[model samples]
Target: MALEKYSTVLKMAQEGRYCVPAFNTYNYETIAWAIEVAEEEKRPVIVQLYPGYDFYIPLKVMCDAAKELAAHASVPVCVHLDHSATYEIAFAGLAAGFPSVMIDGSSLSFDENVALTAAVSRAAHALGCEVEAELGHVGSGSNLDDFATGGKFTDPDEAVKFIELTNVDALAVSIGNAHGAYAATPNLQLDLLSKINDAVDIPLVLHGGSDIPDEQIKQAITRGIAKVNIATEYFRAMYKGYSASIAAAPDKDSLFEISQMSKDSVKEFLRGKFNLLKADV
Candidate 1:
């Protein structure tokens, strides 16, 4: 098996009426765990690297690691750079061999966001890569106030215009979804998502997949969310594994053993998530 393009996997998800689970990975343990679960479930998965992670894990290193892991996986896997806030970082990810990059200009004005996303799209398309653009602001979930005040649902009409102008392979919508762990359970705006879906033909993406109710997420998939990003839950799963391992055996200090334990925990967590998405083997 080889690393498949993000556009291809997303398309499959879109047509299949199910969303693919995209897990954020910063190191070998996380990346390996995601791919291992995807292989076992026989489902296509996207391994995403956030730009902020570059401080600890270099972009090139993560990209190379994802490519290598995906190359030998039994199921299709795609490498993506998530929420790249700048063109330079997005370009660097593409150059580093990521098949997908997100140009996040959601904070900017509509025109500016369109211009920035369009420029990145042109460059990415030229290199046979896919570009994802965010249309509305998906605020941080840690701040419930921000969730109420900062977030704006994507306008169906604007989504049509933005996708037309940017030529993005996927459009990330903010319809009552935020990033990070939710302070409270989210009530997804599936009707709004349906409107956006009706307006645009490209695949739709949902961020802040951690705490949304499973039924809401399933409804979202039915409405056209083809990709869902999960970060906080995966990170929490790894932390729980580490805590349990140290508590059970305080004297155990083998890095390999600890890493394996952590990976196994994350794999089990992902298996449940994959099943939630109705992923098939």
Candidate 2:
């Protein structure tokens, strides 16, 4: 499939009993590994980058990499901006040929959030890009330090209002999810998620999905969670791979071995997710 708006991919997940993995990337090697696994499994995945990551690797390079990966990959890939805090970055992402972009105005007041998100939605749609916006604050980790907020749940009624006002293609609800690796297992607000799901017609996204039990993840997907954001687990695997590589070779570090090890580690996690989601190649 050609590169398309995330709305189409997200809709497919809802109707098909699956959830698309929106994987975060930093370097070219990580992005390459993600695309390789997605292509090998023939699963639709979103390559998501954030504002902080934009400094490490310019947005232009990332989008170009994503475009090239999508253009030639065997399966489907969508390039997206993960947590855009302001309209300027959102507009930059739209102009960079991203197929989807997220506007995270959850830190703002309800009215301001709606207004800013509406503006972003308009700009993104005009460029043929899908827009995803957050309803409630999801805490920070994985370099999302500014996104942190205490345990707050999105009001189902307010979610409906936000959607109506913003006209976003997808909604990312807080629902007790956070940004980084949890110190303990997170208590996912399944009931709250279901209420929001029932309130809105658009696809729902779950952020900070790392460390959640597989059963809970599956339940979220079945109950209308179309997109799941995963970052910490991927970082964990990379750290594990490098640590093992260093332990095995006390003298020298093989860059190739390190890259392949990280790739193998992530592939195992992703393959299981694709299978559980009932994604077919």
Candidate 3:
């Protein structure tokens, strides 16, 4: 199958009442593992590239690799640019064949965020790509206090207005979730999510999906979270796998063998995630 549009993938997730897993991949191994597991589990997956990783994995390289993988995968797969902090980076991803791009202007003033997101949306849509924008800030996991603060939760009314102004295909909302490994168990604001769902017609997204309770995630999906982003968990899993492989076989001299060990571990981890999200081809 060809690469699917990000909006279309999320729309299916919305209609099916399941949150599609969007995994951040840093290298060829990680990307291959994610796509392989998605195909095996018969689930659609979103392979995303963080702008920071672009320094190591060129935008074009990642896009071309994902396109090639998706082309041959048995399940639907889409390539996305995640947490793109600027219009230039987001545009570069879109131009390089990423069907979905996120312009994260959440740290800016509300008006400024709206303006920037709108600009990116207009440009991306003109090229037949989808735009995702973050409204309230989803902070780092190291700061647990940020999740507890009521101020960080996205206001339903503001979300509705933001979508109206920006014309984005999806909205990433902050509701007691943070990026990276959570310092403690998260208390997701499902009520707040329900209100946001009621106010906005577009698919809703939840970032910082790592380590959140499975039940909490299921509830969020039921409440209208169409996409969940995962990064820390996969990174840790792959690293642990690589480390263990070297420990078990200290004399192994082949780089390809060591890389395969890490990819296998990542694939196993992703299989569980696909099952958790109830992804079925």
TM-scores for all candidates? 0.96, 0.92, 0.96
Q: lDDT order of candidates, best first?
A: 3, 1, 2
Candidate achieving higher lDDT, 1 or 2: 1
Residues 1-281 of candidate 2: C-alpha lDDT, one tens digit per residue: 84756888888777777899888887777677777888888778888888678777888889888888788877778888889999998988888777788999998999999999999999888877789999888875433332323346788999999999999999998876778876556667778888999989999998998877777788788778888988888777777877877777767667876666556666777776676654232
lDDT of each: 0.88, 0.81, 0.88
Look at candidate 1 and tell me the lDDT of residue 144.
71
Candidate rank order under TM-score? 3, 1, 2
lDDT of 3 by residue, 1-281 (tens): 55788888888887876779999988888888888888787778999999888778899998899889889888889999999999998999888889889999999999999999999999999999999999888998888777867677798999999999999999999999999878888999999999999999999999999999988888888888989999999889988988988998899998789877767676888888876774222
After superposition, the stretches of candidate 3 with alpha carbons farther than 4 Å from their true spots are 279-281
Better of 2 and 3 by TM-score: 3
1-281, model 1: which lDDT tens digit per residue? Answer: 56998888989887776689999988888888888888888889999999888889899999998899899989999999999998998999899888899999998999999999999999999999999899988988887754555347789999999998999999999988899888887888878889999988999999888888888888888888889999999999989988887777778888677766666667789999998985232
Worst 10 residues of 1 by lDDT: 143-152
Off by over 4 Å in 2: 141-151, 278-281
Best by lDDT: 3
